[model samples]
Target: MEILDHAFMQRALLAAVLVGITAPAVGIHLVQRRQALMGDGIGHVAMTGVGLGFLMSANPVWVAGAVSIAGAVLMELIRMYGRTRGDIALALLFYGGMAGGVLLTSLSPAGSNANLVSYLFGSLATVSEEDVVAICVLAAFVVAVSLGLRRQLFAVSQDEEFARVTGLPVRALNLLVAVTAAVTVTVAMRVVGLLLVSALMVVPVAAAQQLTRSFRATFAVAVLIGTAVSLGGTVTTYYQDVPPGATIVLLAIAVFVVFATLAAPLARRRARAAQAAQGAHDGVRPSPGTADDVKV
Candidate 1:
């Protein structure tokens, strides 16, 4: 309770809450599409934007959002057109973005590896009011795109061919997913850092899937899990004096393990029930060759 008195802590908690909500919101679609690593790629690309913000003495959040959006769009293009060579192209993009960020950060007069470290590993204690505003705005966009258009996004993610046949704009929706993911990366940068942001995006959804059978349930549970961990981790950091990003990620992983463990028994019970039902059906055959049991 005392920690809440500090302006910085208040900002950090707000940012964490937003990260909790937005990360899994967009990530569910990525998971559905089997592109769980897309957030990681966008995080990598966002690094260049962070560097550029430092060099130009501008806000890194906005710069990162712009740069990452471009990178995500490019990645989507590669995915659409690169065909057999998409993986290689993406690898190149990932490495190039990282190298460029390092080089540009070195060129900035006020930027150092130490400053980059904060963004890479998260610096919740340093979150400014402006960052909170940026995060809120970005989070709003992510929520709108990920939730407001969930059916369309889900249709496209589940089956692009089928979605296209159903009159959904598959390519456009895909690009929107990519861009939304990029925005989410920027929104989470201040809370979970770039390197671990993808974990927040993907792990909550993974954890939710362990206990959920439908996409809607998964999305809701993932968001709940994400929120719990984000707030829990942030509060833990205040007491333990640990890295907020690492703490959040580790907490998310812990939740995943718990969900997985609990789900095992539930899954086994479902399997057993299904088997029993089948057995019962099979056992209901006419006994002693009754008239209804005549051979076909």
Candidate 2:
């Protein structure tokens, strides 16, 4: 593979696989539970952590991971209070996190303003071995947690109330989802950066859902989609002299859009045909007054 031949290419490929595996493994649950936007919020929160880490001359990944965990806890609390207004809570979390990061970066006395650009947009080309190690550690944590709790995660994802009725610890599972999402966001931030990290979590999952019926199948599809886009986008970035993060995000968006376009009409047609067949079976006669009535 072109992505494995060179050293940098190999690193990028490794990072892509790690990111792809973790992002969608956690993302499928997030999307199924309607907490998809939580990644975007936590990513921005992790940026604030990175910024704070820089200001304190600390390890950015460690600080970002810690901050993401704390932020995720806060998100859980807000969701508890705003259950009916979940998106509003998420939007507040996102902008609040971004603004906090910006304010901290600006107010910091030591670091150059240029440091902000790296976190805000991305600097994946400058990814060091240490960063890759951090990514791997976080990714491993995410994977271990996901596989360990797969059944509960799957049950809660499909329907929390039903899962609770069936004896799953619903609250603990909810918090588990939030924590997993936060860790996934932190890992993804390394390769895709803060602004585009959520796209990595979201787009591939969306594309995969179009083609898969089982949860396991969907997660597998998502990982495949994620790995392909990450590796392909890295190659494109090298050849085209483009920003790696932007290229990867664009490629993911393209994949999701393509799959969604193809799936939508097919799903609609199937639904319509099913409805027509049901109507025929039900023997519901319609007045011959309007065209739709005649068809009905």
Candidate 3:
């Protein structure tokens, strides 16, 4: 109750829920495409954007959004033009983004670096009223672009070569994905910071994937998990005095482990049940571990 009594906490809570809903929309694409770390990379680029904004006396959030989108587009271009593939390229680009941010911050005022740690680890109490508005607008934009192009995005994400074969603009779809991911990262940075923004994007989806096979179900389940993590972490931080971003990420990891552990037994039970039903339909004996033999 004390938490909600403050305006910043209210904004932070709203921001958390929005991030919980939107981060995974982009993350599902990243996780399925084996590009989950892209959020971290873009986050580093966003840090550089923030640094640049500080140097120029501009709004860091806007600058970070612009720089992050540009960086995302640039990475796609490099991958397309250089014919590079795999994590190696992304890894290189990620390091470059971080190095660039460090360099930019070094060149800026001393105070810029002082505030950098907050961006790295997150301090939701510092999320201003204006930040909530920016985050809302960006998150909405990211989701709209993502879902509007879901068909083509899904096609490309599934198989780039196949999407190209079918006459889809694979390159453009890839760029769109990167751009949306960039937006997700920049907006999420305000809540979870650069270091753990990837977790906000990837972890819940990873947990949900363990529970559901269908994309829609996985997405829905992930939203629930993320929302819980956001609200839980924000509240937990009040008592623990820990960084809210770290709290959320650690909470997500715990949730992921719980889901993963549950998955194995559930999967085994489902397999047994399926086998038993097949045996029964064929007029054969059900297996020993079949659902017919075991309590539900």
Candidate 4:
């Protein structure tokens, strides 16, 4: 295809697959903790960091990583001790980050808006050699750490209180998780963008949860779904001339809807089977005097 002839598209596809694989690994945990919103929060914060980078003539991705890490840590601390509800804390982060990014962008040179737009919506033309390198390094790190600590992360995710009772270093593990998530979001900006990164981070995991009950199976399936969708979306973008971020995200959502639809009937079947087995064991008959009041 003429699309494959472009080196930029090739790099973008490579970056997309790398990010698609890693984002869901991190996100499966986030979704388990019900912290899937954290990606959106960190992503918004990254925008401010990128804006500051443009102001200072630095690499925006690195700056965004630093800022996103700070934001993630702040969110963890706030959730721990701010006495604010979870939604409120995320909301505070969401607004504060956007406001800061917008203000900083306004104060920058006139042409900086173009850079912000690229960071926000994504640009296939924006993937560079450096971006590819960063994506690979981060992807390796994420996959390694996530698998290495899978049991502990699962312990904490399923029941933080139980994990703490079992002598697990719950707080330390949580901090590590936050930083990892922040780094993933920062690195993912090029593929799906700051505004839409959560879609990729979240939707695949959501779909996986519907299709499987085993946590390990869910994680594996999510990574697979994410990788497949990223490749599909990248190719579709080439042929259709559509936006990469939207195309990828909508595909993930569409996949999730399919899983959800299938899961519903599967769940109903299980429920009915359980009920039937129970009725069979109990002889399907009313007890004692109550039988007189029951229909034949």
- lDDT of all the models against the reference? 0.91, 0.79, 0.85, 0.85
Model 1, position 25, has a per-residue lDDT of: 96
Return the top candidate by lDDT.
1
Off by over 4 Å in 2: 1-7, 83-92, 107-110, 264-296
Candidate number with the higher TM-score (1 or 2): 1
Model 1: residues with Cα > 4 Å off, grouped in runs: 282-296
What is the C-alpha lDDT profile of model 1 across 64-162, one tens digit per residue?
A: 999999999999999999999899999999988888888888898785643888889898777999999999999999998887899999899899999
Candidate 4, 126-203: lDDT as tens digits:
889887887788778888879999999999988999999999999988988999898898878887889999889899
**Residue pairs in collision within model 2:** none
**Candidate RMSDs in order:** 5.2, 4.7, 2.1, 4.8
Task: For candidate 2, give the lDDT.
Answer: 0.79
The count of residue-pair clashes in candidate 3 stands at 0
List clashing residue pairs in candidate 1.
none
Name the lDDT of candidate 1.
0.91
lDDT for each residue of candidate 3 in 1-296, tens digit (9 for 90 to 100): 88888898899899888888888888988998988887888887788787787777677788889999998998778767766464577677777777776777677775534488777888888889878889999989987977798778888888999999999988888999999998988888878898889998999999999989988788788888888998899888877888899999999999999999999999988887787778889999865656544457
Off by over 4 Å in 3: 84-92, 110-113, 287-295
The lDDT, on a scale of 0 to 1, for candidate 4 is 0.85
**Residue 182 in candidate 2, Cα distance off native in Å:** 1.0
Specify the poorest-scoring 10-residue window by lDDT in model 3: 286-295
TM-score of each: 0.94, 0.84, 0.92, 0.89
What's the C-alpha lDDT at position 252 in model 4?
96
